[model samples]
Target: MSEKKFQTVQLTLEQSVESRTKLIQGAINRAAHTAGVVSLAGKGVYVIDGLLMKSGVTLDVQAGVTLMGSGNEDKYHHRPGPFELLRNQTPICALIFGNQCDNCVISGKGTISGNYRCFIKANQEQAAHIESHHYPRPEMIYLQDSRNVTVEGLTIIDSPFWTIHLAGCQQVKLANLTINNEVRMPNTDGIDLDRCQYVVVQGCKISTGDDGICLKCTEETKRFGDCTDIEVTDCQIHSQSAAFKVGSSSFGNFLSVKVVRLLIVNSNRGLAFQLRDGGLARNFQFSDVKISTRDFSEEWWGNAEPIYITFVARDHETVIKPDDGIENVQFSNINANSPTGALIYSDVAGRIKNIRFVQTQLWITTEVGKMRHYDLRPSEKRQSLIMPVSGLVGRVKQNQQAGLSVMYRSNEDQPD
Candidate 1:
């Protein structure tokens, strides 16, 4: 059956953050039983707090409007228990929580600003000491367990944490998004697809401090663990961390993920897989990528490797199972300029298997002050290992068949 659309509810509110919060939440409550459109119109910044989405609702942030997220701690709702990234007393939440809402949309040509300036602790970014607000930072958009969601054409800015997080969502599409966070800010990931299935992200221009496009199977979303059948294409991304990555958390299985036509520039790492929590990542294809990486401040993870795929235990004593690995991964038609080459490593034999690189060209940029360490951070005491820079460097366990199909070009003529 077709959706029974309700009349448009145009929100008119005062400048106070509390008023906007009340009005927005009231509109959602009023539309709970039926499908509706909550339109934020006009050409001014509306101080918005936590707004929970409802099913079949569309949040129409109009062309000239802006939703400015309030930084006050008490204005928004938060989780009862502390998250792993937060202090024990700090609360975790999002500015817009689309929890279990199906057929919802957040589409606009306007902007959504997280107003991270109010949350900045100290403006410092260098050598693993980026000053951050460890206290009560919230994500920008947390769409949890929702299906048939579409977020497009919005200019999302200065997110204190992850900008667009689709946690356990199905059949979603994100397109034409312009996301820009402070490049030196910590943990401001552009878009994170956590335990989601059947998602497509295309035509996004994202520049952020952390990973531009990341896939995660975190412990929080363990119940919905099959993060598979996703595609990201035609995106221009830049980040202090990996432009495209899967991890820092891989507790759940991932399969059939494809990323193509990526323009990655000035990122710390071009592509990566940080399988820390020991899950299988397989049947992935990365193609038609133009990547340029440079060494950034040690404050972030990554060390300029154009292709970094590592399957190592997070801790020394943490034992990895025999099947915990990345397998059947292919990289095709990739051209990269970076200070370091690709690093594919696995702690056990056959753990990293069936890798293919076809028409992969590399131009190793000059390494003046860049670190020569393969950093596997969020691990045990020894987080990094000093290594010689080389083209397509890998370290599988001794006597393991690499199962390689290689076409790599070093000293390739780089494009202007």
Candidate 2:
């Protein structure tokens, strides 16, 4: 990395206790420059780049202080310029709560901005095809591998990749964070937690080109563990792909994921849960979600399916036993407005149970044949919907009073 020349200046806040905000913020910038790291002793404003910590560090900003990223936008605001580069290094994560460090907190109304390629790249890869040369740009922020971390009331933007990526971490609480990557530049996923547990994503607004919130398990057989006890609530999400998705990478089991009270719009697929037969995915719920799609027809992309659930089979060469299947999944109070409407499909080889849609109002804004599935029917005309497992029984009978009641036989018996 080439070293950029910086004119340094310093002021000690403990001595100059009543220093003006301008003096304090300037001193922080100088101190961070001189030390080759961001180490401002007391509460103040700071803007410097390439902050590397030799040992673990804790950045505790007081309630009213702000930790801002150095950035200025191009004249059009369509592209971001260098004034936003937080760190000159490649693996540029804001708060690296390293493995051995616990009980770390990044709080206050601090604004962290950088041209995060990881943030921009993930979103870009989804919206359009990217070339081979753009692979090495910075992509992630706030990588946590520790326990008991809390991030609240922060504005993090212009990330090159996913805003916050947590891998194999536990007891994380993320609340009241405003993360916007709505420009649709490249690969900007809002939040992705790979193989993490006890994670809570609540009260956040995420707009991107890819999945707004993605919870992933193991990518392959080499990594073995489950992602469990994740809850997301009271959030607004928009994307080019599924607003919320789980498992294009379910090599590890994903259990106990719950989502509620979400408002999602302008997505190709509103909510998609995919299981890759690598491990078991069970006990999941997607409830009270309001979804709107611009177009649902495959005329744009033949592979896009809204509200999809599938279990991808194992590749023959790997000889990995099919360890994943979805069970006990529920979708309730889902209201959708789509041009081509939604599709509910599961692969022939997958196993699913208790897929219920309670009070689902699927509005086909245009009269089209493919959306016939969302229309209601009478009670006596209902039939047993059968796929692979023959005796599998579900009777969807709609009435003017009760709306829809889909009843199935108890799991104890499957007829010969």
User: TM per model?
Assistant: 0.90, 0.65
TM match of model 2 to true structure: 0.65
How would you encode candidate 2's per-residue C-alpha lDDT over 185-291 as one tens digit per residue?
A: 44466787777789898998887766788877644322325688999999988776667877656667788989999988677667766544345778988889887
lDDT of 1: 0.80
In candidate 1, residue 207 scores what lDDT? 97
TM-score attained by model 1:
0.90
**Reference-based lDDT, residue 411, model 1:** 37
Model 1, range 370-397, lDDT digits (tens) per residue? 4478888877755887776667677653
lDDT, candidate 2, residue 121? 28
